[model samples]
Target: MEQRPGKREERKVTESGHRRTAVAESGSPATGARIAGLGAYRPQTVVSNEQAAADAGVAPEWIAQRVGIHERRRATGSETVVGMAVEAAREALDAAGKDANDVDVVILATCSLPTAMPNGAARVAAGLGCRAAAGFDLNAACAGFNHALAVADGLVRSAVARNVLVVGAERMTDWVSAHDRDTGPIFADGAAAALVVPAIRPGIFPVAWGGDGERADLIRIRADTGRMEMAGREVFAWAVTALTPVIRAACERAGFEPGELKGFVPHQANLRIVKALGAAVGAAGSVTATDVTHTGNTCGASVPLALHALRQRGELTAGDPVLLLGFGAGLSYAAQVVLSP
Candidate 1:
């Protein structure tokens, strides 16, 4: 018998005089990584501005003028965060022509879980039937998806994972007070996912991420009340001004000018901030996503949900250069460029 080159083999004779052999296996690292597919799931129950405003003691027009959200999804009793993630992931895997066995890792990005114990990622993996896939949760508030995406890119390029499933799922209603006008109308529930795979040419570019701990108090979950609190005016100001530079840096790192972008998908924080940031970055020619108008702000799930909406509308074409930005509580922010899938 002959041994193959570049491979090591060990041979030993057993006490019974039988021959035994062992060989070490290795995987070749990928040159880059790309999003192979995308999917999203929004709850069936719709909360109209009129309904939301009645609880907050405001008029429907006020909700529309303030957040530009006429309606948003509210998860039902059966729509758990992990359950929504599984549905989104299944659609993504199908779109990528993959199955549960194809997933090497599952990253669930969220900040609004019912409880801290038994992370949602593991449950999501189990629901998807990805029995052997590595699973974990990542929290960067609304920026969670972008942060998870960066991690997935590294895993694929480093040969740590052949296919990485990144899902952003949130049940914001669980953390927000329906009677609190400031947080109620602006937050919603939904989930979205992206499947990343090894690629010969990079599709997911470098991420430009940073956090402002100094402004962490701007948005938070009040320890005493166990509800979300936000300085709407302050967050809006910071997003329009501070996030412009981050978006530019991401495009620069990807070797693309703002004018070259085909689409811009910022966190569906609010319609005002999304439009302001898109214009400030000079992505005039790009189709800007206004998913917030219908989906409101889903926190961690916003970015991927917005992207999926664009794809469904036929506003994004395959291989088109799209810039994604996510920012929220923790005063955290992240931006990146990815070719449309």
Candidate 2:
């Protein structure tokens, strides 16, 4: 699992009398960066609509019509955030024909880590045997994967690193309350990862990201109770109306028309939001990812998980343009277009 011959060592810095490892950075711009590989991991335990409805005190049909989830994965005690991230990262590295040590940076996008002391990325890097890699965490809620992808793109373009591993992993069930129907059946657990490396041509486009901190309370994890809460209808309305501009901006940045995209992979919050966003963008010719039908709302892991599923189904192929939009908690949102790997 060592890097190939002749790779540079990762950077370390001494600042303010404290020492720390850092992702290598150079002022010179690179040729570009592309997603070289992708992978995903879902939990073993599956919860059906009937099971979820019974727990939520609702009808199975009501659950189906409301969120469009038939079933979703629930992590067993044996499965964990770091472990799932490692599994997905390993598969992504294998798909990219790379070894763990080849990575110089690791970025994990998540919001549901049980404790906040040591970040999950460092542990994941350690698990993968990337002893020299600089690791960090990012929290943009459902928009996390896309935000991390954008950061990876900029890092590569600015010569911050030659190889970056970006992973989105969440254990959302921990934040959700079983008695709260709004979130009980909606949130699930999973992880997905992508490998970004320098490329001769642009495989990733510029990202368009923004947030409305004014509406932060729309989806919040109560500090006192540590339970997740949401204003479902308001959030849904905001997403359907406010996000299309973000989508259009990303397409404009990529020099692509919506009709030219091969696929659309938005966060799998629910099916209604997914379809509304798709229709708003008029991506009639693109294959829209509906992984929420099976995977439920995985929050941070939603985008990459859906992207991996699309690739597996042969709905997207190398060099095909795909639009990715992620919006959720934080009242945050980000969008980008990338060439499918």
For all predicted structures, in order, the TM-scores are 0.92, 0.93
Clashes of each: 0, 0
Q: For candidate 2, what is the lDDT?
A: 0.90
Worst 10 residues of 2 by lDDT: 17-26
Residue by residue across 1-341, what tens digits does model 2's lDDT show?
22322234454544442224333332345667899999899998999999999999999898899989999998988788899999999999999988986887899999989898699999999999986788999999999999999999988877667789999999999999866899998999999999998776788999999999999999999999999999999999999999988999999999999999999999999999999888988978899999999999999999999999999988888889999999999999999999999
Q: What is the lDDT of residue 54 in candidate 2?
A: 91
Q: Write one digit per residue (lDDT tens) for candidate 1, span 175-284.
A: 99999999998899999999998777889999999999999999999899899999999999999998888988999999999999999999999888988888887977
Clash pairs of candidate 1?
none
